[model samples]
Target: MKKGLLLIYLVLCQVYVYAQEDAWVYLTDKDNTGFSISNPPQFLTQQAIDRKNSQGIAIDNRDLPVNETYISQLKNQAGITVMAKSKWFNAVHVRGIQEDIDALATLEFVDYIDFANSSLNRSASNSNRQDKFEIEESLIDFEYGGTQNQVEMINLDNLHLSDYTGNEIIIAVLDAGFPNVNTMSSFQRLRNNNDLLGGYDFVDRTDNVYEFAGSNHGTKVLSVMAGFVQDQYVGTAPDASYYLFRTEDVGSENPVEESYWVEAAERADSLGVHIINSSLGYTVYDNPNYSYTPSQMNGQVAFISKGATIASEKGILVVNSAGNSGNNSWQIVGAPADASKVFSIGGVDASGAYSSFSSQGSATQSTLKPDVVARASSTFVIDQFDVIVNNNGTSFSSPIMAGAMACLKQALPSVSNEQLKQFTRMSASQYTTPDFMMGYGIPDMQMALNLALSVQEETFGELKIFPNPVKNELHIQLPSDTDTTLMIYDVLGKLVLKKSFNSTYQKINTSSMISGMYILRIESSSGSKTFKLIKS
Candidate 1:
């Protein structure tokens, strides 16, 4: 009789373990009267509030933190595992069995229960093979192959020449995982300078992102933005600060990953990230019912796309990759990329032609999808082994464009995110007639900077400055005779020279200034204009 009871007990234990699965328990409300949006500092970083203030974004209920009372009540429940929480949707994501889920539904605060993945299966990234595309040697401009050319192709180096290397800007990279970034020699500078602001593994519910076992795809992705190895390799925004987030589950494609993504994005916003670069996307899932139809790529249909749009509405610039399905039957971009607010990126070749494998856009809504394109085929990046190599996909293209955008943001901090988007689209090669393949072609960063400068110069028109790399003298040309106060400050923001003059043309002796970058602030009765002057 005792032996029979032991057997029964073992059977019950097996059933208990097998019964548990992943499900989401949606809470109706926070139900906390203590929290308020007026007290933003209690939840959001000052930098986050500053970004919203600068962009004219108002603080709302969505900015409020999740109710701790609801969380405490859910935590006390048995057989329920809370995975993540989202303030935007006012929901809690949990993993539990059918019986426990049913019990939770009976609670007064429980709104409903939704299954994230009823079937225990992994949703893998489809067609994500790391195939090395062939490259013609003749098309290569530098020893670095398409990596250096990609920067020059878009005139991104011009921004670098102006010393805008993404300094002071924070970018959050949301992907699968970063394995070697913590130990890679190529990332030594980032590690030594303390630019790698640390990371979190949402999938495992751990803070040890570096020690976890994950795909190297995220390592390569981040290298395209922050990797630097002197003349051997230079990323687009090598000096930018970064926060690494592992949201993708390399083994699975499920609605849970979407929730994880939204949670990560919300965290990034609260931490004051200026930009988010996400190479992950969602379309098909293991469960047919959860898979999204191509018609659903209208941006509003996908949960991830909606979350991405909300992130943008909160004044964060989201950059996502257009999926790689050009040759497949899907032949279209994925969610979040379909969201108009996202800076969706597609792939191109060194020859400025759209890659045959790059995804096409224009949602079922018939709106242009990918905002721009960058070199993807034969795109160069550092591998896990610390070797410089080429890879293919819209994944590389997205970060390439994202890094350059960060550099541009550093250069023009006063330019609002929306204005920057408009200037960027206008700076594209095919802005006049953009199609699905390459929304607005590759953007020219120099052109965008010039356009921004022109707008800044509108208040004081027809002003020409010459001898940019000046050693002794600098000349200014005015459209008409006007009284002006010219103040020149060094890169350190120290005033070097101050002069008041009234003339159509004036020559200022710059011999006394040191050889470096100087800010020329020209203030007149009409307005003030500032120019970046290089002294050689």
Candidate 2:
């Protein structure tokens, strides 16, 4: 009996290595048109694409096996608990004893192997960055809205645009609970569209999460992501689909909540959730031993954070809140948000400064956290009864930004998630340089879309408008072996130049043109289209 016990313990220790042998995140092996398994519909192509992005791996370069040969070997073997036919990464997710893990690292195709246990549920990430700009805290009293942003918060015409709206994209919002959300008038369109996919309650370990209420955090979260209340407050992407997840315990402090987050994330993946907006985080927990040290911010200590990272690898864009400890002594960011793979979001005031209460970092492991920021302090949300309330914390900031990402995703459906992230960063308020407070800075989604779609200046599809703020010289591009048309118009909607081409390329010398706001429209038969060209 004693010897048997020893053997079992040894097996558990080595299982991870063995299990990892063929497990990999297949980024380049995508064929995603759609999915239909659960809430958001589980899509592998999406998940894998996300993983390839954070690793700094090029989308094309993502094809290399995290563990290449071990995958083939495991597929050939017969006794392994897991078997392979075809896989997300061209590798299989193997099940083995702890004794197997070491071997996994040696596998050629194996990038890194992690337990899949946590993916089923995950906690909301916490608030992190704070606005550097400080104003009267009561900006909402006179403002009535929330934080005073240069761009005032706008409300959606939910009552008026009920059936007629251009928003049709799927946006998964991972929050706490949806109590009364189903019965609210504000959420009527969401109910009508049946846009909400099924969700799991990771907190109480039961599905009746909606019934148990408090501040109805989840309801408020949904409102911010997709609520439509005219003249009051509006979410950035109100028309997007939603999958509400309950992963936090507004009541407890046990360290176990992290596990719940992991569980939620797995479910999100299985559902092929387009975007996961988790506004919870872990730094200190109920257990004294559980309180994470700054080192744990590396993104490897917590199961939920690791799952968040893996989810990103799988192509599901995960936007997480940093933490609300920015004003505290331990102002460093929290777990999962620290996960190098996830997009860590910070809170900022309208002036584009970091929120004082937003957490800070460059992570210990995957440093350079809080990828972006949004209005957090003094933000508005809807309670369970559909009443609007102003709140503070990075929690409010995450959904605001997530809403924007959904719109961006809808606008640039062809760009890969990795490209989208990169493009957004490049097009940020501080792309050329970065500040610790706001990271890469805020994003200009439409501008990002334009840049992503822009053809190389030297290439035919490349459309160039030169002489900015200029009195002359507007140039056009012509690519080889392609049909082309270039049209220019002034701000007054006057058509300035319209040309049809039979040559590989054409150049329009705007040198003889007037300087003002101009729009250039380019269209291609290959389903390629771009809009908004500035002519100076």
Candidate 3:
């Protein structure tokens, strides 16, 4: 009889363990009755406030912290364990049995409860979740060594020569783990200059981001931008400051990881981070019921994607990997990468070809994704063990582009994040003809800088160009009534049309031109002006 009771008890224990689940308890209001947007310093740092003010981004309720009173009340509830909280979404992630999680909805402050396991929820929504080191020939001034090809492929070398090496820019790296970043020899420069700011481990709920026992993916990713060894290996943006964040739990895949990411992003925003390089992407979860469908890659659907969009709206440039599902059956870019505001980076080979493993964009989405490609195939990085090695995946490509963008940001401090994205896309090799595999293709940083400068130095009087995506006739309005020379060039830099116009308003016949992107340059006595034209 004792043995029978023991068996029954063991069975009950197993059931209880299996019954435990994760969920998000959303609060109805923040209860910030006395908070004011004008006084942003209460919650935001001075640097963060300055960044918003410079960008003309107004401070709003989203900047307000979640109500601590509501959180404390939820903590007092039995069987409810608060895991993570997000101010942006006004939600708190918790773990408990189905009944315990559901009971939270009865509270006055509780808005609703969204379970990680969709089957357990009453709502309709479902949520979810390297190689060797070597040294090569140096071509530019910086001793890039093995990383020369990856940097030069995107033309970031030119920016380095001009001393736009991401000085004063703070970047937040959200990934799995960053082991040995403090002890690595390549990161000594960052330590000496205090560019390795600080970090937090959202997964472990601790301040030590480098002590996680998970995979060292974050460490490798950081080396692509922050690693610097004299004449051996130079990262893309060696002078940039960084805040390492561990958000991913390598042991298990769950929606709570997404909550962890949102929390880290909020922290980065409060600390005034300029760029966020997230080499992580989410689609499937350990619980199949919490898995996301490809149709949900619409950017607005996923929780993490929404947080990323908010980060972008907060004046932070969010760069994410396009994912490595290209060769798999589920061949599409993952969420957060699918977010329209994110600069989703794809991977390409050294020969300027798209990497087969780099995830592609879906055809159903109206917006073009995998915004740009970078040299991620066999990309070089510094390992946690302090060895120079080559690795593959869009994971490395995102940082390559992020570091280049930091350099561009340093060069054009006044340029907004949206304009910087546009300039980079316009500078891509395949901007005229983007596809699912290589949307806008690889960016040329030198060309991007030139485009930005051209727009900034438009000293010529206001010129109006209408019907930009012209199907037949193209209209051009000159600033002054003077003889203006108009020239149009194809993506290959070949002059296609050249004509002289005397009238203030001129109409050019473009009915016979092919459908693609063209550069229209107008030269006159006032000044020369350039415009990008699309012929539909």
Q: With candidate 2 superimposed using the best TM-score fit, by how many Å does residue 101's alpha carbon deviate from the native?
A: 19
lDDT of 2 at 452: 60
Candidate 1 residue lDDT tens string, 94-169: 7677677668878888887766443332332233332212222122333734466889988999999999999989
**TM-score of candidate 1 versus the correct structure, residues matched by position:** 0.77
Off by over 4 Å in 3: 1-18, 32-34, 124-144, 456-502, 507-536
Model 2 lDDT on a 0 to 1 scale: 0.59
What is the lDDT ranking, best to worst? 3, 1, 2
Residues 373-478 of candidate 2 have per-residue lDDT tens digits of 7777667666676776667778777787677667667666656676677666655676546766677777765555555665223222454444332335445544
Provide C-alpha RMSD values for all models, in order.
11.0, 11.7, 4.9
Better candidate by lDDT, 1 or 3 = 3
Candidates sorted by TM-score, best first: 3, 1, 2
Worst 10 residues of 1 by lDDT: 130-139
Candidate 3 achieves a global lDDT of 0.86
Give the clashing pairs for model 3: 129-283, 129-284, 129-285, 132-389, 133-388, 133-389
Q: Residue 379 error for model 2, in Å?
A: 1.0
Report the backbone clash tally of model 2.
Answer: 91
Clash counts for all predictions: 2, 91, 6
Q: How many backbone clashes does candidate 3 have?
A: 6
* Candidate 1 stretches greater than 4 Å from native: 1-24, 75-79, 97-103, 112-146, 460-536
